[model samples]
Target: MAKVFIYPATSLILSDLVARFGHEPLGAALSIRERIQTPGLESPPLQITPEDPKKGLRYAAVEVPSGVRGRMAIYGPLLEQSEAAIIVTDAEMAFGCMGCARTNELILFSLRQRGIPLLELTYPKSEEEGVQFVKAIREFLAGLQEGGS
Candidate 1:
């Protein structure tokens, strides 16, 4: 089965579809819940590793660019572990993380750099679009089953 990373990670629809298709969904909520429930953790932006500062910082401490690194700390691992990715844009309308513009750029850039099999979609507005959205997702995931680039 493929490890499919879903952007926003908290969407009921996407997660359900991925699981229904027999893939693991790497969602943001999963990451957040793991971090929050980990023993001894109090808050977010926790250190990924001891701060080196020379390399980019991953903790929620520190201030731009680096803050991006901090926030990405929570997210980057999920990205790295994925065999494929499904990113939904215009998700803010659906109460998903629109995230920082720069972070969006970074995430998209990193995904492209990794050259994984990727499915990019716009969140649906109406019933017809929703059908097309699911169709696209189903096709992409089925392609993964068949073997992907």
Candidate 2:
């Protein structure tokens, strides 16, 4: 299987998806604080970063660009290297985000325009619900694989 990029809004959701899918996540925890809190969110051994830009890709980060500076900082590198991206949002729009909705929409639009596959995930109402959602995603990916084969 090729590398699949999974981006979840929270560390918990990202961990659950990676564990269930049997693919070790890449940068599931983006920072020192996250790494300390969630030690299990490291990239799998299979992951390789190709300098050529074709064979390797990075996982998308959660930082949304709110203004000119932020936009310049975040999107260029992400949209350039990622062949596919997964975006997750808290079901209730937590994080007390001020300008996130618009920013996310624009990012999604840009990603789509580049023909990159983007999966948008929403948090489930309960833990069980989250599991079910992950299962559904797994099944969906399975179907795509089978069809592609």
Candidate 3:
């Protein structure tokens, strides 16, 4: 199964939809939740050693506007491991809000630079729009499954 990274990872609805379509959803919220809940690992999120915030500082060093480094630290790992990506551009705080604009730009830029299959969509407000959104995502994921771009 493809590891599809869904941006604004706090969106349970989108993440669940991705899983229903048979692909693992890679997102920061998923990792954070898993780390906090799992007993064998670190209990609180701040204690986790793998995704160090210091590394994010290194990532920011390459660019002039380095404001997003801290936030990127949390979200960048999933982006690196993803085979495909889906980003809801108009996502709200109800589903999930990316509080930082610079970080969002960096994530989008990184995804585009990767040149992998990417699906960019708007948040659906109505039932009809939601259906169409799902169809679009399904088609993109289906294409990936069939080895198409």
**Number of backbone-clashing residue pairs for each candidate, in the order shown:** 3, 0, 0
Q: lDDT by residue for model 1 over 1-149, one digit each (tens)?
A: 78887875556568778889878887655232333354422233435553433234442235546546755666677777788888888874343553466666777777777778999998888989989999999998877862234
**TM-score to native of every candidate shown:** 0.71, 0.47, 0.76
Overall lDDT per candidate, in order of appearance: 0.67, 0.44, 0.71
Off by over 4 Å in 2: 1-12, 15-68, 92-99, 140-149
Which lDDT tens digits does candidate 3 get at residues 4-52?
A: 8887776677788788888888865532232234552212245545445
Q: List the candidates ranked by TM-score, beginning with the highest.
A: 3, 1, 2
For model 2, how does the per-residue alpha-carbon lDDT over 1-149 read when each residue is reduced to its tens digit? 32334443235455455446644333223321322233232222233333322321222234432242243234445555545555555644231121344544655565667665456767678889878867766764443331122
Best by TM-score: 3
| Best of the candidates, lDDT | 3
Off by over 4 Å in 3: 30-44, 48-51, 62-67, 146-149
Worst 10 residues of 1 by lDDT: 34-43
Q: How far does residue 1 in candidate 1 sit from its true spot (Å)?
A: 0.8
Cα misplacement distance, residue 94 of candidate 2 (Å): 7.5
